[model samples]
Target: MDQLTPVVPDDNKQAYAVTEVTPEDAGDVQVDVHTHLRDGVQRKMEQRHIQMIALAGTLGTGLFLSSGKTIAHGGPAGSVLSYILTGSIAYCMLTCVGEMAVYAPISGGYIHYIERWLHPAIGFAVGWQVCIQYCLFLPSEIIAANILISFWDQAFPKARQAGYMLILMAFAALINYFGVRWFGESEFVFALIKIALVVGLIIGGIVLDLGGGPNHDRIGFRYWKDPGAFAPYHEDSGFGYFLGFFTNLLQAAGSFAGIESIAFTAAEVKNPRVALSKAIRRLFWRIAIFYVVLVFVVGLLVPYNDPNLLQSTGTAASSPFVIAFNRAGVKVLPSIINAAILTSAFSAGSSLMYSVSRMLYGLALRGFAPRFVAKTTKQGLPVVALSIVACFFGLSFMSLGDGASTVLNWLSNLNALLVLYSPSVGFKLTHVSIGYITWMMIGVTYLRFKKGIEAQGIDRTAWRYYNRFQPWPAYWVIFWSSIVLIFSGWEVFTKGHWSAQDFVIDYITIPIFLVLAGGFWIVKRPRWLKAHELDMFGNIPKDEDVECDEPAPKTWFGKVINFLFT
Candidate 1:
């Protein structure tokens, strides 16, 4: 038997080597994929980078720029409940993904898992949908970054905005074009800045509410009471408040959209099992502190009826935190927050571009795309895939046109597809008053994964990371995500609130996915695998995991640093 030619660089050859087996010798799909593709990629992302990259993707403009919209629509209590409800669902869904990602840590993330575990047609629909989602979403983030820069001067002309957009796109392209290491390090720094800003803003919000700010005015739920805990949506009755809460619920989903980037990069992390496990475990706290707490504080500080809440300035000026600070007679914080959000927007765009490129690469590996797209540079950068996906950045120029809002609406409408169709995917859908069919697909995929594992009799103890609550998390996600996906467009159904364009945009993706998936199913006529016969172990690259080991922290300080950073 020919010894497998190790794919690592010369310096790393002694540290990493595969067993004696050629690609042809491996009959299993996983081994063949491993022999051919897995080792071509470099594992440069550290544990800290994995944690923060997930943060970078999730903590973007939705929280900083449009969270105020949630408050304005739902009022303080309604908005808070919306975020809490959505955040819980997101947490559960990530745990399901964590289990699969930690086990295999494959390149394509959940899309690959869905293909192998569910039907390939389902995977095709999902993978292409996500690619479409990010292609549109990447420019939207760049457009958002341009808007963030406008915080300094809302009067900046379209030409100037176009210039800023160009600069932002170039920076994002630079970050991703090099490799995952650059992507990881950049996101780490951006995530830290975002974390600091959100923490400071949360603390600042507390101070402003307690009369500790320059105004010395005690806020203490005054806004909630005056706004009466719930704002009417499209009417001034009981049904109106329900609509308000539901609308905000859908919006909150958008804020949590890109959290699943962790899964996509799992294959590129230094130590997949340990690093991904740490990131997944800490995700709950990150979401609660960064998102739930921040929104709650914003609600306490700003009333739902604040006219500025609807400003849509696309800058810090419209941010609830910024609004609260200004009302408290503090002026300096807005600029600082705006700068941080600008970085956040850029980081999100860069990260989304990187993720979709990897998704396209995975698609190529599955024969869904051209084989040439699967080729990577020596450093394992998917150059062709990156270039293809990066082209969509041109769409950001649309935001500089006379019909900027209309352009954004079109891009956003297409982006409503999910990370697994995360909250961001749901965000685009809800933005147009549409249901989240793609988001529901995530839950269905996870259930299929769970069913396959059980049917195959896989041992739980041997897994790198096993989520504490088994099947329940899958069930939890499916139930609530299904409810939201189905009823997400309920407001449009109200008697006085009908629009054909809105209705079509709301549910259009449903059929697009159905046609793609169904057509693939009909043409290929792929045989369904019994749960016991599923290829759960085939695609897992055990040799890839063996090539690297992260040393444990020895000293107390090292341990503390490891705990905090990891």
Candidate 2:
């Protein structure tokens, strides 16, 4: 058997050895050895694989099921604004993450970055928060899947739900167990189906607007015009409306929670430099086109005050997509939409499990978790960590018996602030880099020149992809994140009833980061920091050292896609 060669310079090399074996020989090895081998090499996920994972992460019950709630809370105009605003924030954060992932794609993703740049305690806390969020997603998805199934037949619905949940989970486990490529391929196909459905819906919506459907009244923005163009949910003058807007903003931000999944997959991606860059570039438009544009079209087609919009309560049947289909008088569309929702939920749940398990594995590697959980399978699957995550998901099922609305609200509240916090803090810290800091300043300058850019009719691909309009999106992130952080505590000061939730969210990020940093400093204080091991914002390497040596595409089709996308 050939030993794996170290990729770094001899002076920087650590005392680790790798032994490779054939697949037949692999089975005969002890489980511990298998685990070690799996954990040894960093699995490089390909471009399509990253795209598939990103698609699965982004298209969830949130778009279908939760968009209505955002509409109801913010009204039609405010809802659209909220999504656009939050989407901008997410876009900026992803760009920052892209730059880092391109530079050094690691399996641990941000958790590893946090550990290397900040401290182990901060990393552990972030890891815990991420894991909790992902695990909670499981039951939420399961309940959603169950509700979708019941739409077909109520007979033995609960049993069907349980069965489907287990089956989907097992399938995810099997895919992951084989290796990264299998998971990527499966996700790719599933994601393509979703993208097609969405595109078809958008086109159908346009046709319906043109009065092509039965009983259609040339629905050319009648909902918007009749509803007074832009319904701002708050009539209160002064800061009151702003306060309401901020609350709605948090909810909107939460809807885009999983956008960071692109960052999570950085480590596993095959060519971090090209693949990560393309993924980040695509992310901006995808959110703008799929989420922002879709929401705009839906709002214009369906009134915000529709009874169904307010009835969501986190179930698939409550989804605006179904409501829109039903409104369009499209018979049988609801069932198709429901089935799509089921697949979307399963994909999201699988993604959650993968993210949480890898986070646990990262934590364990850093000694923050029990060492045993760090063990991996010969195929490079973190079996023990994955099992723990699965168990946590099973435990989340207890929340099912709790009132669905309450459970959903609690989960929503818990996740809303934390979701934006990680990326916000991560970006701000990453901006400590000279080039990134320069971009941040340039982004701010560009925002001031927004009017000029708009006047020039610059294509979105140019403005958003190139960040040409100055802080095209980063400024919004800084502005809104600051508002949420501050005003989350305002009710306590003004109305007297303290919001523990607000405090937990607003104050949690810094302490969590500090504790992690402090712990790492106390324990394994390295004699010197390795350049490759530094966090996003740490000391910038010389241009030569910073260059990435990504592998070439294995096939012609891959090379073409890579060329087009990159």
Candidate 3:
């Protein structure tokens, strides 16, 4: 580590260089990685867009559409409680990520820092896992959009429906092809529409629940009482009720997937430290308001036993939100909500493709993926990575053979396994129930915080963004996360419930990551990284490019919009 070399032509470029990690990876240069793409392309995501992306990415088919399935499995009370608990765990991980993101604000985000603090092999495994999940998710979401479109017109030709998916996928690539700005702006508009839709739905649900619609018959909590707060699946009441709760726990995780996106993509966001701190600070309330509150309201309106919920009709007919509106005789709301669902689902596909492409590029730069994958356009988009991910749209063809419904289930399960590898996901909540992630985050948080103090001398007083409760929250998160993870797959072991597919799907990632990472470590033979030796700032750019050039909104209406959206 002599004097740091410049990564870009302009000295004003961030002080990002090929950092040195453990002495063994590449001797003088740490883990071998391309320094930075300082091609004069600025970080384009505005502070406002940051707020909406976090909200919009998570509010997808899971919340507006699939919540009926969760309610069917876990009942209303159980589902609501599960989201609260799982959301708490996700918050802990997000905050842990936030503390480091503010300090370094790099592209690889948590995984990159995890490699520096934990092991390089672990970092590599996690990064590639993220790429795989996004790769899988990108196509699944496209297929989902196609399915949702069927709700409006069942007679629409399947081939043409698929053609629409391709066109939409290409459009998404173009957004990322341009840069983060396009991705940010597109999601901003998408997220705003969704926010308005959610707000409208909540108000309407409350009105309908109170019998304010044309029917004018106060239903109150009539559905919850008759159906009770719990629903037993095929099993006995005691165990069935409990298993359903576990099922809903995973559901909540799926809904809030990408909780770590803001932290991971901190590199591309302008004013990373301040923007991320605000986003993370507001994250919990967003989950509670958009998800928890919505869940509570939805439960009060729709019963767990609704035939529409249990049928899996693959259309707006099955959505609890739409079901409630239909029951209330609301003429046009269902159609509107269905349309919003389409846009949101499409937006999710695009955003995930964008995220995975960047993750792939980051992996390539770190010497994990092929060097060509890291190749980018002059504007800084990972064009090669984008092309590879976009090619996954070919997977949509699987729907033709097995049917879209069957292929979607397969992709969802695969996405779950990869969730253990990649923290950024919104597919299945049960994935979070696996618990290993919780313990891993706790270990990383504690080790990083301890090492940061002894090594970098970081303290909350000076560091604007730091995880709260210090070493304590990490311990609690580990405790709860472990319990959830162990029992997450426990139902599969039930006497009559054993299913080999369930066991493998739930626990598969544990061995895959361990063996790959362990094997890589053994071969690399990096110096034994001691706890105290962790470099909290090893990868941090020496001089951050501080360009808060976007002018703030000054008008009264603009300020109001900022308060509502941001």
Counted clashes in each candidate structure:
8, 14, 7
lDDT of 2: 0.57
Query: Residues 1-566, candidate 2, lDDT per residue (tens digit)?
Result: 43332334332122334666443333222212212322332444667778655544567666776667666656667678877876777677666545445544555665655544444444555666667657666666655555556667657344555676577667766766666677777787778777876787788777777787666758887777676445444444345445445555656554566666576676555555556666776776788878887777677667767877767433446767667767778676777777877777777767767777877876676566788887765556778888887775564344346643455455545554443221110001110111121223323323322333344453434322244444435566556555555454444444455677555654554454456456666775644333333222222122233235666689998788556544
The better-scoring model by TM-score among 2 and 3 is 3
Cα deviation of 498 in candidate 1 (Å)?
Answer: 1.7
- Clash pairs (backbone) in predicted model 1: 30-538, 30-539, 253-423, 254-423, 257-424, 418-421, 418-422, 419-422
Sum up the clashes in candidate 1.
8
Output the lDDT of residue 123, model 2: 56
Candidate lDDT scores, in order, read 0.74, 0.57, 0.69
Instruction: Kindly list the per-residue Cα lDDT of model 3 for residues 1-566, writing each as its tens digit.
Output: 42233444443233345443442222122122334333223466788788777765668776777787778888888888888887787777766777777766776666666666667787776777666766877777777777777877768686777677778777877877778888888988998888888898889889988889888979887877888888886565458987888777766666766656666567777777777878888887888888888888998888888877765555566578888888888878767877888888788888888777777766776666777776656566778888888889788778877777777777776666665422222233334432346235535655565665666444655766776575665665677666766667776777787888778777776676777688878887766566655654443543234436556689998888677754
Q: Least accurate stretch of 10 residues (summed lDDT) in model 2?
A: 424-433
2 or 3: which has the higher lDDT? 3
Q: Which has the greatest TM-score?
A: 1
| Cα lDDT of model 1 by residue, 1-566, tens digit | 42333444463222233556543433222322432443346677888788776654578777887888888898888888998888888888888888888777767888888787788898888788778777777877777777677777668888788788888899899999878999888988888898888889889899889999997999898987896889998784458888899888768877887676578888788878888887888888888888888989999998888888887666777678888888888989888988988888788888888888989988887777887888778787889999998899998787666545566656665554332232321123434321234445566777787777777676766876887677787778778876775676676677778888666656666677778899989988888887876666644656454347679999998698577887
| lDDT score at residue 335, model 2, on the 0-100 scale | 70
Better of 1 and 3 by TM-score: 1
Cα-based RMSD of candidate 1: 4.1
Query: Any idea what lDDT model 3 has?
Result: 0.69
Name the TM-score of candidate 3.
0.89
User: Order of all candidates by lDDT, from best down to worst?
Assistant: 1, 3, 2
